[model samples]
Target chain A: MPQKHLVEIRDNPLFASIGAESFAALTRGAYVQNFPPHTELITEGEAADFLHIVSTGCVELFSIWQGRETSMSFQTENSTFILAATIKDLPYLMSARTITKSRVIMIPSQDIRGVFERDSMFAKSIVSELATCYRNAIKTAKNIKLRTSLERLANYILKLHLAQGGRIELELAVEKRRIASFLGMTPENLSRSFAGLKSHGVEMDGQVIKVVDAAKLEEFAHPNALIDG
Target chain B: MPQKHLVEIRDNPLFASIGAESFAALTRGAYVQNFPPHTELITEGEAADFLHIVSTGCVELFSIWQGRETSMSFQTENSTFILAATIKDLPYLMSARTITKSRVIMIPSQDIRGVFERDSMFAKSIVSELATCYRNAIKTAKNIKLRTSLERLANYILKLHLAQGGRIELELAVEKRRIASFLGMTPENLSRSFAGLKSHGVEMDGQVIKVVDAAKLEEFAHPNALIDG
Candidate 1:
């Protein structure tokens, strides 16, 4: 079963450009394993040996300094994490944990980096992936640098609303605390931010959020594709 | 003159991986020119056509939302900017300006992406550069998410101190207002932050800073190699 799953991942967009021989080498000893919630797959400042892909459920990437932690991002199904570390054979800067019971594929980083040199197409894909990741990180940085907590929350809810088919009302896809962490705010502050946004047309009742005026909220949030995307 | 400068850039660590032929292709029409301080070189949301390298002086990357702008980072000599945008052929998310009279090299992005596919070594160089940028951005994000303005200022001073041969007294390389923007704080808050760090062993008078007790300041800053590096 693990072998079958490994073979299938070759078609994953991340590996799509990988040649047959290189892909086989990368997946040779790859395995699918399931973990319970809160599983720590990788640790910060430690060498990462395996490149992880979430086959099901969510993986949270976070960092810590002086006993304080912050969520960097989340990877969903079919998404990969720690590729840059895997490619460079360096210690991971962030620790990754399972946000829910997760099925993850672990492929040896040695094999991956080794194959990087032997496969031209695979190398190109890595460049593209790295570029995309770099751009995405810049966008996230802008969210923190350019917006207030209230503006950040309003824009986030709008994104979720659009993603959920433009519904006026919607429940959060993740826990409020996790969302708060992801948005770079305290849970208490996030609660207050919700109240702050009430004047901006956002009403939060438990997990359900209703945007009374989407245009008004967007104008207040100034959701630019360059910053938010 | 442009040919001489282009040839020198081929020796930059960033282009070290490119084969002589590929490097020649990349620098075929490259030009190195000087710009005055505060000269805006690139704008957010505009298509990026050239990959810029700071040959001398400094280049500042900044972003704007609504009408407010925040400094993103500074690219010093030998460093490249807008690389991801150049490689992806996408619009830049941050605009760049010169902080001082600067010499910069501009290589057409078309030549870069075209050469990227044809040159294996150049491709590897790009993958490495992108990975570095990604990890560096993550570190910056952690700084914002985990530390207070005072902590950020202390750490920034410590880094400068270490870079300046562990001098007890140090001068900021850039204006405090620009540093404040880069650290996600206002000039007024930055002033307060500097004052706040006095108890933590930092003594600042205008642009001159002295770390009275490095250990005390380090303790307060809780400088983590993972984030600060």
Candidate 2:
């Protein structure tokens, strides 16, 4: 692997605490490649041969059943995917596709497991990283089960607002259709929901969302840290 | 803690591989207690002080929002809840309550982190257990997002049938309402879905379910290992 790519992967919390020798072993067989937008990277049920980290651009995790598909999540730079499957030696539960021209690093699963077995610090980091992933999944479940489409969209907007450092104007990174699927809504419903939010001081022109009044949005969204964070 | 309780909890994958000295440190401050049915053990947003293991009977992890409550999952003997929160020293994302008269073992979160830092074996086990949890949650998200209500019910019945060793007759351990909530459907929709499944070889007499034709149910359910396992 290139030195820059190794440094990029090392910056992740999962690899930040590892000793120099173990880190070298981890990236010894690792390789990086750039993918075109909308490229299929991996399919569900395939053996997780490599742990993938998004070095640049975007990767979307999705699942399909009986010709019906839903977006699970989106990954950006420095974020890893299929870590659990690679660690468990199981099939990938969700498929990964690039949403934009992206650079991704592929580390062999055996290398990850080897270091994990021999290095206690790497093992501890995996525990913390996996725990964080598990908690995030639970929160997604709670958000889907306990809220309506309107409430979900409102909360999502509030989340993006906070993520962008409480900016009054924000841009939607992904497309509308993927956002619709991620929020468990149809494209039509997402449009209607956006229209509905206008009454709460949200105005959108194309993909640019302008939050006119943060206080009004918060009052209506009721974004709870337990679920939103 | 009682010797029997210690034995029961040790059977969990999270603690099965720890050293004796680390295990002793883990259980030093642990204690056991019994909770009556419907008793709320911990509420969401509260600091996770103790890691809970169900020693006997049943406990249900659930969440509430805007007066609407949803069941996340049910735990029987030997299963733990809010583990991610305990490991992260964060607030409980979901509240837990007993579904029946249940005995639970409570271990301090600090002790778990303490042993985890000192024992690589325990850390490795934690990696495996947490990976299983994260994957399970992903499967659940796929099931909820990709399947319809009728399909969800059919697949759930097939899961129970397979879980009971292909038994012709199976039993529902939980009430219909909780099952409905867990499946992300209203009670009325649950009854209608059950009625719809009769054509597919599933017959229900109260909580007892009879899978008269396994092949027919599987054909309808179309259970995929990626989503159902």
Candidate 3:
């Protein structure tokens, strides 16, 4: 664990608002761990032991049902994972795995709870983060319940385009299969859905997707209805 | 607005963890409002103004798309509504309407944010509440994506049965039409689905549903996979 990575975790917005002294105290017992790509960090239905803060690389949060896996979220640098399950001391609802060699700060949930009880700013930050997460979850539910596989793919492409400064030249953050599962569709359906979006003004070459007509694609995809954080 | 209603709002778990003095300050500029059945209290996509606390009666939180309505959640006595939108100062995601003649306590979102900045316990309580809501939303998303309409209904019935102390003697809390929308199906589909469940050992008399073979129903519903919250 490098000293610089420790500073990064303390500076992340999830803990940034807490007083420096309290943040330092909270992380004093924390440790940094590194995992290779494809390493399983936590398994679904297992007791959550630590509040994991992603310092570098990527992690995929997913759930398995009847032996089939569904991707729930993808966490990158500066994001935290599984805070709700850790806070509640409940079984992990989703499993987490390292998508790339990753660095993460691990703080005991008990220590985090102690800081929450003793530091007002820390608790406020926690509440704000949780609220944002809750809102995002609702948005995800709307996507799942109301939209078809094709519509979801269109929205996802549009979102990725916007996330990369309103351009589609950036490489996709995840593979097509993972994206397919995240959008609640099969790989074959996703392939067909991508072909359908092409006629609606989207052009994809491998992982690169181009939105030829942003306004027309927006109308076709109804992106406004599928909100994202 | 009765003083007793103010007391009830302050005493509800949503505000209970805030100190008594802080709670009083929260209610200082608040007011009680009454609405008749079917009155729309909050419209989706409009700017959020206040955090609502239900004092009496019931309210349905729903969303509209392409001229179709979907029920998102139902709120009753002592429950709060739209906290996520209010806290984030974002537009409401769902419209709320009175299902029965209702009394509601409206606290300005500004005041709620003020309390968060000034009180730690209040903030902590908000974190717990929001985390629970977020987890529940995730569970709902899982339900929508992983289960078919009949499987969803079967698990929903079991959940209702468990919620009512493993008994189904009481009238259903919501109508079949609303239940259909909540379960992501049409009313006609729900009717046929209910008939299908009867073959799996469920018996229904009007709103009253009885599970003649709980084990068989659980097996068909795959309760463990659906047990998220």
Per-candidate TM-score against the hidden true structure: 0.95, 0.99, 0.95
Query: Which clashing pairs does model 1 show?
Result: none
For B1-229, candidate 1 gives per-residue lDDT tens digits of 4666865697677798788888888888788889999999999999999999999999999999888899999999889989999999999989999998999999999999989989888888888889999999988999988998888888999888888888998977679899999999999999999988889888987789998889898887878888887
The number of the candidate with the highest lDDT is: 2
Candidate 2, residues A39-127, lDDT tens digits: the string is: 99999999999999999999999998989999999999989998999999999999999999999999999999999999999998888
Model 3 Cα lDDT, one tens digit per residue, A1-229? 4679767986788788888788777788889988999999988888888889888889999887666678888999999878898777777788899988998888888888888889887887787788888888888877777777888888888888788788746577778888898899998999899899878888888887778878877888876742544
* DockQ, all models: 0.85, 0.90, 0.62
Better of 2 and 3 by DockQ: 2
TM-score for chain A as predicted in candidate 1: 0.94
Candidate with top TM-score is: 2
Classify candidate 2 by CAPRI docking class: high
- Candidate 3 local lDDT, B37-57, one digit each (tens): 999999988888988988888
Ordering by lDDT: 2, 1, 3
Residue A199 local lDDT, model 2: 92
DockQ score for model 1: 0.85
Would you list the rank order by TM-score, best first?
Answer: 2, 1, 3
lDDT of 1 by residue, A56-174 (tens): 89989998887888999999988888988898888999999998999999998998889888788988998888999989999999999888888888889888878878899998756
Better of 1 and 3 by lDDT: 1
Instruction: Return the lDDT, model 3, position A108.
Output: 83
Sorted into a CAPRI-style docking class, model 3 comes out as medium
